[model samples]
Target: MVYPEQQLSERQRYYNAKEIAQYYRSRPWVVIWRALTIVWLFARFVLGLKLDEWFNRAELNKFKRAGQLRQILTDLGPTFIKVGQALSTRPDLVRKDFLEELIKLQDQLPPFDNALAFSIIEEELGRTVATMYRQISPDPIAAASLGQVYHAFLTTGEEVAVKVQRPNLLVSIKLDLYLMRWAAGWLSPWLPLNLGHDLTLIVDEFGTKLFEEIDYINEGRNAEKFAKNFRDDPTVKVPLIYWQYTSTRVITLEWIHGLKLTDTERIRAAGLETDAVIKTGVISGLRQLLEHGFFHADPHPGNLFALADGRMAYIDFGMMDQLAQPTKEAIASAVVHLINRDYVELAAIFVELGFLTPDTDIMPIVPAIESVLGEAIGESVGEFNFRTITDKFSELMYDYPFRVPAKFALIIRSLVTQEGLALTLNPNFKIVEVSYPYVARRLLTGESPEMRRRLIDVLFKNGKLRWDRLENMIAIARSDQQFDLLPTAQLGLQYLLSEEGKFLRRQLLLALTEDDRLHTQELQRLWDLVKDDLEPKRLFDVALSSLRVVSTEGIAAILPTANTINSL
Candidate 1:
């Protein structure tokens, strides 16, 4: 099971910005000419719009201007197209009209020459096309900014997709990045941009990720890693990478047969429940972000398919990102803070996560954060969606000192694109409604020590138990079909009996006693909630299974108490 990355050289395995800069520096004329053309194009459309605004001329149709901008990016080539796709998710930077148009950049770009694409595949793979594939599409089935995918069948009669990268893609992208980084330095002082972070750093961050995307070998490895992560999940599917035929410039993957998640009519006709599809997407997405931390950053409709068997298939693993352990914990905690409507703590988390500068006064920003998030969430979590929240938060960012960290750019893009896809399938889809159950289940299960601490923070305050929170978490967690009653109960019992549970034990004891008397009312309420799920047979089975993990002495110690309970 040697990975594709292991076959590549050191230079091919990672993005080397300095090497790219040096390579392009030897060809200065290429950069200068391209930079001039880009400047002219922007001056004609972007600067022209600003000029029109300053002179207070007749108002032009914003939608029309946005279309022109999209066309300009399309003409500019792959690098600009990628930038447009990134901007499509940034409601904070781009206006509504432009954002709508930039969304087209995801998969709507025109294809390159078919003959050239075919020739490149042959050259890169070092094989004649007729020998390698039994059949290949005469034209690309789908065209994206970086590459176009051709549906083909291997000589072995297996259906596959052959992806061919654009001609001179690295040369074009390198020149563009170098020029953009150079320009960011010169323009930062004069431009009226209010982004708190340095403009050049953003360009570098985008450059790093863009470099990662062009290496088809890296993408093959990404697909494998992602597949390994979801190995146990039956509801989600990742395309198998044909590593034998994969190279730096071309990749072959299992051709998925399904309708796009956005194709509602066909999806419903296939007898797939739209809500169930959305649930799978949301839950799988939560696992990627909150659990595995390695996530598919680009989840556009074109990259996601709804299979006939009701599984959601994710393709295009080139644009993926990972989160560190601390970052994962911070995100989970942020969700809790948001649910609690604790804006002050939420603002602090934002600062800690680099969304705000340390010197920024959070006190003045707290109420504004509350107002935006509160209005979106209101009394019902069902009302919340990423688009609505981002739109409002965009305004807040404009008025306040908040900034979008470069690392989080793809994160926001992934979430917003997912919600948009969900909305396309079911107009009434509420992401928060589907998301909270997964988060609640994760908190309740307490998979890690940090998570257990978070659960405790949510369940107790001032040395007192919050029975309502515990009950509500259970209610929400049970809604997930994957939630297992016996395992969760066993984990809870094990933790309660451990040394780390000393504080919780004291708190529970205190909670069960009042005025020198024991109160069974809360205990009875909890039992009533769990009784249906914990049938006698299930309990007996769980007890029998527990014998493997529990020592005989441990069981003997608890037997007398169990006998007393049976007698009662």
Candidate 2:
């Protein structure tokens, strides 16, 4: 259980401390201003008080608050921008204004001089710009807070996009991280909410990723890994990396010319099917999560494209996550439990997934899940909204001893962004309907014996099979891929022939299905075999006498259904 410490070079450690010290020295006012802002916001929103002198009247309005926050983050620079981007995904923590505006928060800034970008590329790659590309665009095709991209063609006639990191990105990011750590420490004592634990973890995770992202070589590796994962998938396209031209500061990738996924009108104008595009996106997302264990953490519209030939292309790979298989299976199980309205199983799943700490009592979590699932289970299949259910469930987590895992947050963000874009393209798009195929396929074909047993538990009641659950599984399986139900049916038939199975089946059908009568002529044949056996009849009578709960309608349903049991 021992963990190894990370090894950092002396220079790196020095710079880390230096940046922290410089942050406070140069920008104490920034920290103070934000601290005051937090206090004012908590008092105004949480406590319902108006501080007329500290804030503008117009900015205090709920509708204007998101814009105000976005402007504040943008003005604060790269570190806060990253913080805002991370906060955008946490609907449980932030208000609607903050969530909406932060989702639209762009990191775009005016491009640095083309000459400086060219010089850096040449310097990083150890070659002149002329030798790297036959022709390279002087103007940047796109510019963001950290880097700028230019279109270029290699001498071999390969068109590519050259991304050059900003000159002082590392230094600026370092200083910003320092400022963030300082601010977090400064605000820790007086914060109204018990967010200190979650806040510290978030900043730590962000810093870990921030350093990883600044290394262009790591980004190249991420793209290559994604490409390897989807090498055979024609629907998903990952940009090819030119490793020979890539370095810590500059990366060269195959240029893709396509419309952004958000541009629904243009995608339609180009004769692309919106439904197919969304389906492909969802399928690819599932494969990354369930099959490969690696996923594109950032799937916003800006990083996705709809190609001319109707394929989906993903660009930025700086943000990616590796989900462990156990977590993935738990998620699949949770989905099935939710669909079946099994609140107890779903509550245990939350504990199993590490959202709840081990040894913590689950009794308290069960009611919250039940309240949400009760409202949800009544809805028809098409009425299911994944985001709405997820948001509601998240709202419940705010008061519980639940920790939001980083990968879980990224998964939510990716789906929310994709779902929003899909709805924009087609108003009637339902995420669960499209995603159900994946979950269903996994449950039926999954390798876990325990999971398979759970499936049987859902299908069986008091050792009697409920044919409807069987039929639903068959239907869901048939919708996506071919399934051979003969084995499952044979297993059920084996149980039907056993002595205990008869009583269980009789009790289950009578108690569960009210009006759905079953034909049970086959039961007469089985009884005819036992009629001659006086000893077995006596045993049955004894067992029947021990029953304390019995319903007349249940017995009536069983009689008719038992007579009608002529087929599997």
Candidate 3:
């Protein structure tokens, strides 16, 4: 449902901390650190603390600390619950125990007063509940941090879920958000995260996303986009939004009666094959990430259901991801190179995709990849082990200078998350085997053409042929570039072209030792005398010497031009 006309009231949507204090009843510090406090409890889970019978009473209290959080969010209502939903999917952000508890929040909240619910329905839809549904469930079928769902049938005869926003939810959210924002301001001088990257940015991001979730209009449009992306694929289901019955605070959708993908008992009882279910879900997730580029980011167990017909249903598009065209191609290409066992290419793609700096040295990360990957590149993904991949790579990227791309963070979460669900279903699903063929085909048959070309251009222009890159390097050098590329890459390449150029100096020294023939290993080996950072240019001299050679390794010596990559 598109509600271009339904705008939130000024007072409901906007308020300062002073204005908000009355409703939420906490100082800014209490409300904001509540987030940090929840994060600390989440840390216990990530650190693998035994919160069950093995944990000490005080240590076991971590469970209560986390549980108390779930209770508080329920008390806070819609905005916080929505916040919880977003937090649940962020593996790159929250720790595992927190993910477990946050996910446990699927349908656990005190229902809003039925009388008040009806009154709000009347006020929102401008119609009575009886007119909308023949019979509305007094008890909500499910409740969460956000809103509760009531099973109903339209008077015209359709089973639907009526999601109602908590009464006075806007007032509470605005006040809590104001307090959180102010607390961040007050705490900035004292906290490491507050100054550069910390709780403040997190709260602000959480607050913004929380408000976005409250906007039924945003979810409506996100759902519409998903339905359109999969219009041709019926195996995956997203409930059709009934716009006429929708408003800023209320959303109505076709009711789906199926076991959530994580519910093993209900699924097994319904006589479905768990392995096939796992395959379809993972494959479809791949399609969403690679083919369509727009996907439901929060496809946690609660949001995915296994239908009677053996199809997986994806719902709850409150948090979704959209990759830019260039980003999509870069990721797709990276996948292909990874499958083909081209570590250098994979490293290069990282730079192309803006995942790392253009001048960043990837040689350091290569051994880590080899250490993690070894010779197991083509094995069936069903048999691939996720623990080995994650454990070895946990600090891999962190070893190099990098920041997680917002999109990649969510996408990685999606894959690792489905792996968790896969453990429940098949317990042996290796995602890589599935991912390999998809990537292999892309590399063999030109999967992401633009990205491939961009990568090739980058590798050739700057990587193998240092002398040829003089033009590109010259532009950066001549322009007074600001990035780290200037002092290192541009300067290094600048020296390679001049009489003082490292490559020329090295080559002249080597060729002076022996009459150098162009484009041979002996020539490159001799040139290596200069230095490895300057080693890439030696290969370029080979390419320029007009040797009729076409080795793939030889061609790979080049690096891509990046001044124009940002446009993508």
Candidate 4:
């Protein structure tokens, strides 16, 4: 049965294994030609490298070979370009020299014909450029694998960026995916792959995301949702989408005027602080992972800009991902487990997060994880960074049954690219230094039940309060300027009197009466740690103000304990 173009496009939004297989099966010539071309390129590069190694010849230097690899991917078109971009962030999979070259794939690509691009825009929007736009660039301002963007102004004098998708993107992407899936099936058996999962699943995941990215309608919606997630955040910016001019092949968004985040010289010339820009990127990135659970999966330097007013602007929302609530909580818990040096729980978390099968024995893997992560975290958390941990974990993946879950592929890419961006601005920048403070503040002040439970887990163990852990968490959280002391205290008091905190209350009472006497030493230690921040005048004002929000019964429930503490 024949289908309309719109219906076909809608049906193609997701990966359909059966449909893809059948479609490619009917195009044997196309597959054969593409396969031959790809194999030829690989043979040329691999043979050259082998010869260089055998003869100790400096003919093809690492930089030259890396450039050739980039050229091959670019020549092969968008699909291979996307794969190159993914590899650019994986230090374990690609060499540093090649990675440096592959990084250019993020934004540096040859533009398609300008005339064809304009025609596509006119065809999609159902109007000539003269009528639709007051002024538009004669050539694309920027060209990417899937699309090229033009700076344009609407007839009503509003500035916008017109992004026109490459000609026949779907056809090219489909053919490439089919060939990739086919190649993976044959290559997996011979390749020295230690990944615990099937290779095709990774291909399928990439295919699905690629399809979504090529859909401008979907990307526009992603932008709107991302903007809403950060509506209250003053430090972040998202371009406004113009739905009237957007389609599956075309998207017009507000033109963002800012400096590329990696351009340190220009940023400094504009009187912007590079350090503050890095902090903004890290904190906003954390919120996306831990709080909203929706994040931009690709945050290369080209996508993030530093605004004139110091806000960080995020553009190009084509690649975004969402985490299930359980997944999100498990990740936050995993961070706490790592900080506490609880490798056993950390191993279990890896299993839960799909890095290992549930049936796999974690006992042997626990020490391996600890040795790798412990060395990466060395002396203090400040020294820890994603790149180091990722490199270490890559080694573990070879030795253990660890695998990169298909779901977490983009998450890793997003994080590594973000760190790469930061490093370009400040060589001394460590992501953990900025990220830990945000995580600590969330654990301390997060109002969700899941976060509250995590907080309790961090603060207590074996039915006793760990005063030292609490003090450490507070000290770390205090480093974040956004951490509000009074609100957190009031939230803590309210939770202590609520139904959810019954377990915590019982645990507290048990610790207090364990020796058949008041255990005031821990309490005194806590008070001393926070005395300066919670001085008498501030405490009194907070108490008086908190009364309006706290129910009388809730206050009554905690009054006896308060009186006992006062007497002490």
| Candidate 1 lDDT, 211-255, residue by residue in tens | 788888888989989999999999989999988788888999999
List runs of model 3 lying over 4 Å from the truth: 1-4, 9-103, 171-207, 372-391, 442-448, 451-568
Instruction: Identify the superior model by lDDT, candidate 1 or candidate 3.
Output: 1
Model 2 weakest lDDT span, ten residues long: 1-10
Clashes of each: 0, 10, 18, 0
Per-residue lDDT tens digits of candidate 2, residues 490-517?
A: 3433333334345446555553443465
Q: Model 4 segments beyond 4 Å from truth?
A: 1-8, 53-62, 89-100, 187-194, 513-519, 556-568
Query: Where does model 2 exceed 4 Å of error?
Result: 1-72, 83-108, 179-196, 376-378, 447-467, 481-568
Off by over 4 Å in 1: 3-13, 16-32, 46-67, 86-104, 182-194, 356-365, 395-401, 514-521, 543-548, 552-568
Report, for every candidate in turn, its global Cα lDDT versus the true structure.
Answer: 0.81, 0.68, 0.61, 0.83
lDDT of 3 by residue, 221-255 (tens): 88888888888876788898888788877888889
Candidate 2: lDDT of 157?
A: 95
RMSD of 1: 4.4
User: What lDDT is reached at residue 22 by model 3?
Assistant: 64
Better model by lDDT, 1 or 2? 1
Cα error, candidate 3, residue 313 (Å): 1.6
Number of clashing pairs, model 3? Answer: 18
